[model samples]
Target: MEQRNGRRLILLPLPLQGHMNPMLELANILYFKGFSITIIHTSFNSLNPSTHPHFTYHLISDNLSESEAVEKDLLLLISHLNRKCYEPFRECFASLVSDASKEPVACLISDPVFDFTQSVAESLKIPRIMLRTGSASFTAVISAFPLLQGKGYIPKLDSRLGEPVTEFSPLRVKDLPVINSSDPERFFKLVHNLTYQTKASYGFIFNTFEDLEQHALATLRKEFHIPIFPIGPFHKCVPATTSTSRFLSQDWSCISWLNTQAQKSVIYVSFGSIATLDEAQFLEIAWGLANSKQPFLWVVRPGSISGSDWLEPLPSGFHETLNGRGHIVKWAPQKEVLAHQSVGVFWTHSGWNSTLESICEGVPMICTPFFGDQMLNARYASDVWEVGLHLENGLERGEIERAIRSLMMEKKGDQMRDRLSKIKEKANICLRQGGSSYQSLNDLVDHILSLESLALIKHD
Candidate 1:
């Protein structure tokens, strides 16, 4: 084995914004802890290495165009990348290992989507940890796919949407992750392989603290034989030293706009980096925000509406109706916006990262989940943690308006805020010294160092 100065880790993020952000936060945390990071990423939604000059970046060109990603079906896009990435990823990984001057690669950390890395890491004789950048509860629900399938619950019927998920406690069928496909069986099979690969990993890393998800963490440990580490709310553990925006240029103007509003008077709206809405739903949200008569900071991403470049053609006089009351941006610095005193309620798609960020900031949420883990996360936010309200029966303007008003103006919103304050305190505690998340992170480093030592001994 070659001698090296410091431990070097390789990270392969899933390349979507929601998936990539938390992984990068993990990279930041590892880098702060004296581990060198090498980020091997795909061409679509790639991170610029120059912006993050400290980390080494390797591009595994998937040859997927921006237009192709937007046009292709979500499942098809993932399937295509999985097939195309394996060879290039193998080559890049092999080259990294064979290089003599560089630090001997200690371990590989990858998003669960890149489960193929388990095999590559095995061949290269390195430890691999699959980072599940969502709550342990959400991952537990998805990991129960086989149970749902055996009970004939998946390939779910629209009629059965209200049925309670008996295998998992306190969740209804509507709370389950939606696999939008004509062939639901095939999609389930594809995801089942991810769990299979996770079981083969050296360990499992979750972006959640133990107290925040006690039962779910217990369930995951019981279900999967692998060691599980709940070492996060990573954003709080590692402060953002610079811009981490991979895709959208953030609009900082809203921070000034937020300051002008009354305390807890503004509702923050963002549906995550992906998840495009149809025209009707988009218009409904617009009218709803307008009718609520509350100040709002809305992040209308460029391609938020299908086939549209902007929300310019919103309902007639939509801007004029709430001219002084609303501030719109292509994207807002979400963490800062949530932490702002003026931001009362968050109207969100309930993506896990967004969910945790809102909780960490003690901000309550109005969940309008789109698909996949979002459904499960929305349920946890509204039901388990009691920090949010869900928007059921789809997006009608009346419902949207009422939800905004209820969360921002009514007593119900105050109750959720009180609950969130306690959760926020708990999250902070977990990341502090001698806390659960802190100890877990230390354990992770120890495990990596042990693996590296064992590998060196074998080589010697």
Candidate 2:
């Protein structure tokens, strides 16, 4: 596209914090490549002060009346994305495309959840790409969902002789792979919807690099014709540039605590924004951390533990024992903490964001996934990437302690660390000049620009 003609782009992100965070990165990458981007958000999400805050922030209603209704319409939530988010976006794009200050909007890049976007792109006859925003292992899991029965993992939904969900991928229902859905049934429905949408997208943009996920990458290339571009380590693509805070990214105070720790000495534990533990779970995790006796930073979100008086009261003496050895805060600047020299390991919920962050930092993981495809992501992180340990499915203080201790001093920990360190080098390389991610990112930009150019040609 000629520089004077202007190239305009439309971006749509999932409403959740975890979902919006990566899409924003992709947008920044597009802007750097010289396309004007208009990102669409949900009314539900833009109001949440805690989630990522980027894009022009246009919102749609998911439109479920109650928690029960949301459950029933779970697939709708996952795949349908609100139609209301679209009209405004369409109007915005039309205006921007015609504006004297900007180029005509040519392409649409959206999250799969926002399916209504496809129609908008179609109405304008513009190419729209979906952001996959997950790991290669995760992509493999989704691609292989129908084949899970051949290997005998999860029971077949339709056939008795079918393979289990575990056969095609390393994730399982038992340990760290599930989404901690708060409602398992609802969670599964959401997964089903996302898988279907993958097939629906014109193409997908991933926030990962090729070196970090060779097997998954190879599988996506070999098995699916769906266009999957790995243009990532998106955080690396950004130059530590600051914008107005979109979502309250954890507590900033944790940064000071991290600064004081010794190199590779502290374990960082956080279960993400939505995964809450109960009193029993909380006590188990607390006691486990105490037993490890390793320095750590733990984020304890209010009401993080379910059914607990513990929210109002810290475990007696826990603060005393943990004071110098560890620090507890509601949230922290996670990426910055992950980058710290003292972050020896991570205890996480295995959310995609957490998984990717740990990978970027080269820190080993202790995965205690709560729901979604977490079990699958963790499986790949531990068994595939060799970057982590997956705690037992039903969590225990002793199990958590044992896992932490193993991660800290055990031979397996050392092996995994060395392995992850090598992988980390690859991630760095991928984001560097002429690297896989860098190249892929450029390709994505060129593709979007090509679409915008076509739109301009059509207009002319």
Candidate 3:
């Protein structure tokens, strides 16, 4: 191992909340280990560096500015950012390298989605480490892109949506991320390019523990030549001493409301930052909560429902009917909400971060996955881990009511809670001194120090 020195590391995170959180968490881990951190972010979904004052921040130009009229489609948004980020990033990187007085840039830790960073790092002779924000199972699926493409699964058609992907067992065709695009071929090409980018990097850092996704991580190690580090449920590893939000202000009032409620009574609901539901679905969800007769805390973010900046009025007489039984907010402090004794159930979109946090808190989930790795995460939660239940069928009021009831007041829900407790225990064990995450984190820092030493030797 190289001797400890104050080295600089530049991080490029995909400009989305889900992607940014884990990257920032990783930066926090490295910063504590004596690395000077510089975050190069894009204007679109830009992070407020003031929250992390210890790290230097640079803003690069992006095609999708916060003030500009942006594309509504997720694929189009991603396409624009990927195409626009390269030039600005290159210029900013050059400036960083030219400065000699500051600690030299030792390595570039990039979100796996941003492949262009790999090329820029290589050109600048900086080692690049890829950070995968999703679960190991999802990464395993993504890492097998070549095989999927060869088997004609890349541009999956509507007819084949229900078929099982035999090569990747337990991952049905429906679980595969399907981009809603007019240009399906272009979408497939974009996915293929992004996923393959990780293979070119020096190593990988996954926000997962060893026991949680052992098989998937094992497969990834077998397939890739580089070192793989599983150091996460990151929020637990390093406490969030600083706020890290670009948007979506959190409402803490719900915490008080949760305190007033009975233990194991309130069902906490959130669909994450990006997913938008139509009017019908929104009403169904509202009616379901109301009909379930369970005290609930729901996050109905601005623009959560399609075609409106705010949720269209819920089912008529819904608020009056609930009276003081339900609490609604634009956003809630999710980790705290899950940790509360009153929050017995989590009705979530099954985003990786939310799933992991729920697991850490031992809160069973009612998963209604939206897109991307969520489908796979939901599968792991419900089927593999047996810590959650999948909300089957479309978003109907009756189905939603039934699912909530099943998860909150039934024997199955108790079993899920028990399993979740075990999972939480495992996560705690892995994060302890000399545990899986603890050892992986130490190894990651050692690897980073070695890179710094190599860079210094080359410069000398």
Candidate 4:
């Protein structure tokens, strides 16, 4: 570990699993670069501090009721957090600033969803940088929301779902991000706040590399007019270690099972931490995997299947149909599983982290996006990148089985793997010393250090 520089950088992460993992990974990266780390988090879905012993942890009440704590509507929960966290965060931040013994504070880094942080950082005269946890292409789509809405494209008409979003090539009307709420205005308001506040930050940090998203990055730089760093594949930038950010315990036994399977023969299925399926849809997936007639390792997160506790709703003789061909776990070490030689295909929800991880490992995907930027990511994977197949229709066992065979037991799958191998090589090259990501990381550190001088100028 690099020696601490006695300058602390504070990070506030959104409480969701996908959001928290990247933030914590970035925290670890910066810590290894020699800055002291402090994490300010909400009491709901609180992180275990012992897991990240190197960092200082602070908790602020989110004012969520027991029911609200288990709220399925993500937008409402985020709105509540924005409204309630402002005062507590201000107080907590003030206390941190006034402490005489701690290192001089450098700047505040936070997930862009917490738009409230921009005002708080301004009030305290602290520089704030926003870390975008999604793809640059998705950010481009978000930045164009007003235009898309003005053009009467949003609140997407079911009739137009298959029509092209002319402005966003290859993206159809249904590929736009969505909220699962009765009030559409609420989602728009949140988007407006997120986009407006992020533009006010000192700089934007994305967990993507230039080679993978050159055009999107170019568009973003022109729009935001702030320093943009595309330093990513963050997990690859650092050594693999036990992650402190997981909400579910990983079942390592799956690795041993993968070991027994033939090379590039096991299909790995996981839909990320969120994204639920009804019992009927869940049954379709279970049967689909069985019907694929290939060895598979599936991560069926507890509570992810609606109206069922764990695997209670699994159909009769589901295991016998597989005849020891499938392995089911509540969770598995996803990166390790992806890197395993026996793993050939990833059936995913196209969550950005999972997408990038699959790309890094040269694994082709079968995308069944649930919501938000997932649809857009899935479109890019299947339509643009040609590294995955998109199951645009709702789940059915026959369709699932065919999609599986096309990727796992056919020439189409070989073509996807070939394309992904090239993309994967580009990802690896960008991490080397002279690579775009390597240089961007250095620039990011320099930018953080320069904030101290900017602060000194303000004080003087």
Candidate 5:
């Protein structure tokens, strides 16, 4: 259902499912709004073409194992994208623009990570906008150009004592979500990737509500010259237009089960894809969830419990005892579960999508960031927004139980909840017709379209 806007654009997303999904959604919206979109996928993400035949797909090989990408682990592939994907990517863009079969690229909308894409746009002299598929607070943190490398801000996280991040705003570092960087080498590279790429992007768009992070948004607007647009939930702006086909079905049974529980009586837990927990970590989490005695729903993806037959050994018949009280499943529809009345809190991996989704639902969180910017997300959640609490590094059961109980039952949880609901209200206002985010998106579309008009006028 693509309307003919008589203009062409390139949509480049990173190589992960989370990145691709939002990129696809935005592309779909752009197409429906009448723009021709050429989506570029990494050599590793070539499966996208088969999955989405509607968009024009170009597969460019990068540093990842080319002939067969499945042979390499994801982190290696991501690293390769950072180190070696640029040159091939440039050649591909150049060729596409010169193809003559299609319109010249009027605009380039790239992922936040592919900040290098701005270089491509510059070479072709087309306007570019970086599409950040995450929270406003996280993007603002990057935009702030925080002393991410220095102490008192960067390396001083361990000593934070859950205290406030000074001069940041109404929020503190302790309330924000915190993720653990698995290996030092990868963490630094990823941080460099997030910050440098953002600074390099022409303009950037975030999938978040502006009202929720006023202080952060103010800080970012002052710091960066690139146009910043907050058009989100992103789900709100992008209709389910042609629900891209995928085999996964969200189980609704959990929602029905949740309905039977008391108001905000349940603790909802999930660690997101790509996070792993050993048997000990798994048991600790289980024991904590069990001890809360509050009814709960936990989505335990396969391999979450770790080791074959792992969940079997937990607390000797723990499942049977807690069977009626707790419902654990391999996978459940996260969004719906969050919206359910029974859910009071989320125990999460501090992933951007998960955090934003929880906030959108007005549910608080207990964050344990696994790696990458998840730590940044956790820090903001606890320190900045006051919407969630966090666990220290140990990942022990007592810690898990205590945190969950306090966040769900303690007076502190009530205070956090009050602040969080206010944020959610602000979010609702931003989604209205004339809100900043809505206006920003309208301007973005017009901005891209006008570039082509300018080129035509110059030729005349």
Candidate 6:
């Protein structure tokens, strides 16, 4: 083990699987780079400190009721957390700053969703950096939210759904980001908060690489006027560790099943932790996979199906129809699964983490975006990157089967696979010593160290 530096970084992660995974991975990366880490997390989805024994941990009460904790409305839940966690986080952060025995605090790194952290860090005169756990393309679109709203492009009128957003070429109005909020005003507020708070950060650390999103990164740099570090595909950058930041236990049995299947023959399906499906749509997907006649590994997260606890809503003899062609589990080891030779197509919700994982592994995707940046990610994968197909017309069995055949058994799929192979090569090269991500990471480390000096200058 390397000796730690005298500086410590405080990380505040929003308590969701996608958000937590990248934050923890970045923590590990910084720790290996010789900085001490302190993780201040919420009680809602608290991390197990034992999982990362090297890091110090602090749990600040979010004070959420059982109902608030289980609130299905994502925007509402986040609003609740922001309002509830502000005071507790401020107090906890103050204690860390005033503590005598710990290393001299360097800076604070937090998930951008916790916009409250900016004010807390400002109040303490701490330099704060934000870790944007999404694609640069998504961030660029988000930067345009106010303009989109002003033009009445938001609230997504049916008439404009298919019309291209001329400003954001290749993206239709329907492809714009949206939340499941009945209150458009609240959604707008959330967007404004996320965007401006990001601008307020000392710098940004994106979990993306330059080659993949050079255009988007350029746009963000011009807009935000902050030092932006596109130093990611974070899993590839970090040394492998035993501890997992996953909220659910991964079913490793799928790996065993993959071993028995033919190479590049199986379509691995997962919609991430938060996306849910109605039973009618779920049945369409089930029948679609069956009719595709391709071997598949599907992750049906316990409560992901509407009005059904698990897979009880599956039509009778659903398993027998496939007869060992399909494997279903509550959760999957996604990175491992995507890297498996048998997985040629990833049928996904197009979350940034899953999209990057698939890209790095050279697996093509079938995008079914549920909400938020997923729409943007799916659009980029299908139209921009040409790495996947987008299920544009919602869930239909016939279209699903056709898309599977086109991607699995046709020339178009082969072309997508070929393009993804080259993109994956770029992703790997960027992590090498002379690569963009490598240099960006070096710059980020230097910037982090310089924050102490910047603080002194401000004090004087």
Top-TM-score candidate index: 6
| lDDT computed for candidate 2 | 0.69
Top lDDT prediction, candidate number: 6
Which segments of candidate 4 are over 4 A away from where they belong?
Answer: 455-460
Instruction: Determine which window of 10 residues in candidate 1 has minimal summed lDDT.
Output: 1-10
**Which stretches of model 5 miss by more than 4 angstroms?**
1-3, 43-54, 66-76, 143-194, 241-253, 259-263, 305-316, 407-418, 453-460
lDDT of 4 by residue, 181-284 (tens): 66678888877877897788888899999988898999999998989999899898765663648788899999999999999999999999989999999999
Among residues 3 or more apart in sequence or in different chains, the pairs in candidate 4 whose N, CA or C atoms overlap within 3 Å are none
RMSD (CA, Å), each prediction:
2.7, 4.4, 2.5, 1.4, 4.1, 1.2
Task: Report the candidate with higher TM-score, 5 versus 6.
Answer: 6
Task: Point out the worst 10-residue segment of candidate 3 by lDDT.
Answer: 63-72
What's the best-to-worst order under TM-score? 6, 4, 1, 3, 2, 5
- Candidate 3 vs candidate 6, TM-score winner: 6
> What's the TM-score of every candidate structure?
0.95, 0.84, 0.95, 0.97, 0.82, 0.98
Alpha-carbon runs more than 4 Å astray in model 6: 458-460
Task: Give one digit per residue, the lDDT tens place, for model 3 in 1-460.
Answer: 2233678989999888899988998888888767888999988877887789988999998866553326667777777787888899999998997789888777999987775887788778788888988998887887687788788776667688778888877777778865575566656676677566777777899999998999999998998877899999788977657555547888999999999999999999999988889988888898999999999999999988878877556755778999788999999999889999999999999999999999999999999998888988887788789888887578998888888889887899999988888889999999999899999999988898788566555546
lDDT of 5 by residue, 243-274 (tens): 44222445678888998999988999888766
Q: Model 6 lDDT vs. the true structure?
A: 0.91
* Shift of residue 361 alpha carbon in model 5, Å: 1.3
lDDT of 5: 0.72
